[model samples]
Target: MPRNDAPDDQAPVASSPPTRLALIVRGGWEGHHPVAATELFLPVLRESGFEIRIEESPDVYADAGVMRDVDLVVQCMTMSEISREAVFGLRDAVAAGTGLAGWHGGIADSYRGSSDYLQLVGGQFATHPSRAPEDRPGDERDNFLPYRVEISEAGREHPITAGVGDFELTTEQYWVLHDDLIDVLATTTHPVQPYHPWHRPIVSPAVWTRHWGEGRIFVATPGHTPEVLEQAPVRTIIERGLLWAARTPSE
Candidate 1:
C-alpha cells in the first residue's frame, strides 16, 4: 500500500467497456423476413460485444426516447410505421453522435410514404417484388438467386471490407435509387427482368456506408431471408459494418 506510483512508460489508459447497443429489431411483413433475419444477426452482434435490445413488438417505435444513451443502433424493423416525432428523435440522436445502421428493405425500402425519413437516410427503395418474366415466383414471395456483387471504389479500403473479398450469394438482389454521395461497399446488377415492364437495366446497391455528423451509418440490401446473411460476403460486410458504424472513421 505504500508504493504509490503511475508508470509513465506503461501504455495509456484504455477507454471504458462497450455498453448496451440499442438494437431496434422490430418485425413485419414476411416479404422482408423480419423475425428470422433479426435472430440471425443478433448472435453476430453479440460476438462483436453488443448487448442487444430487441423490439419484436411494434410498440418500441412508439417511444421516442428509445434511442437515448445507446452506444449504437442496429435496426432490423421492416415495413412498419413510426410517428414523425420518433423518426426525428432517432435522427437527431444519430446526428448528435449516436450510431445508426441497418440492412436491405428494413432501412432503405422502409417507410415508403415518408419523404422526410428518406432525406435523413440518404436513399429509399424505389421498387422491388419483380421477377424475370419467364421466371415466375412460383406462388412464393422470396426470390432467391445467385448474384455477383462488385465492391465500390471508396469501400475498398474501409475496415468492413478489409479482408472481405468480392463474393457471390443466392438471395433477393435489392434494386434501389442509386446515389453518388454514398460510399458504396458492394453492388448487384439487375438486368431488366422479363417481368419488369420498365425497359431500364438496374445496377442495385447492396452494401454501403456513410458519415452523419459525429455518427456513422451502414446499409445492406441482401438479407431477404434468414439464410441470406450466411453467405461469406454478406456476413463479413455486416461484421465489419457494426464495428465501423459504432465508432468514428479515422481522419
Candidate 2:
C-alpha cells in the first residue's frame, strides 16, 4: 500500500485543486427515477470537492475523450441499452483504473438483456423479502420505521461501513441473488411474517461490493424508493461506497 505521487495510476500528480469526478447519469427503467437519484447526490459530491460533468444520456459513452478525464463514475441508469462501442468505452475506462461505482439497477440490474454486462458488475436484485403477498407494502408502517441490519463479518471493517453502525430503514428490504461472491457490508434478516407461506427464515443484503479488475465495485439494494435515499444511514452508505469503489488500491 505504498503511496503514489499522482492521484491516479496513470495520471500525473496534481498539487492544486481536488480531483474532478464525472457523473454519468441516464434515465433507465424509470422506476428508479434517474434524475431524482442523481440530483439527490450532487450537493454532497460538490461539497467533497468533486467537479461534476453531467450527461443526461448514456450515449456519452460514444465519446472516448470525455471518458478519459473522469476519475469516478456515478451511474444512475436503470434497465437500458447503449451501443457496443459505448459499453466498451466504459469498460475500458474502468479497467484502466478509473473508479466505477453505482447502486440499484444502474450498475447491476442495468443491461438485463446483456449477460456480458451483468457478468462485468456482479450480483442482481432477484427479489424483495417483504414485498410478497403477505408482506405486501413492505414495512409500510411509516417512512422512519426502524429495522435491524446485520453486518457482514467479511466486510465489516471496509471503508464503506467502517465506523457505521447497524441500521434500519422503512424502505422495502431487498433480497439479492448472485453467483459471484461479494464482500457484503450489511444485511437484515427477515422474520417470516404470519402470512408468508414459507416457514424457512430469510436473510437479505442491504449493502455489498464486488471486485472487478483494477476498479473497486459496489452495490446497495435499499434504494427501491425515493424516500430511502433521504434516510441518514442509507445516504451515508451510498456516499462512502462510491468513494470506496473509485479509489485505487495503494502500492
Find the candidate with the highest TM-score and give its number. 1
Give the residue spans of candidate 1 off by over 4 A.
1-18, 57-66, 141-143, 192-200, 247-251
How does candidate 2 score on lDDT? 0.70
Q: In model 2, what is the error at residue 72, expressed in angstroms?
A: 1.0
TM-score of each: 0.82, 0.79
* Each model's total of backbone clashes: 2, 2
Worst 10 residues of 1 by lDDT: 57-66
Error of 2 at 186 (Å): 1.4
Candidate 2 residue-wise lDDT, 142-245, digit = tens: 22224587667865678788777877666555556665466778877767767557686777666777766666677777675568777887788888887777
Q: For residues 56-143, what per-residue lDDT tens digits would candidate 1 score against the true structure?
A: 6434544656665566777777777776776777677677676777888778776677676676677777655445546655755445
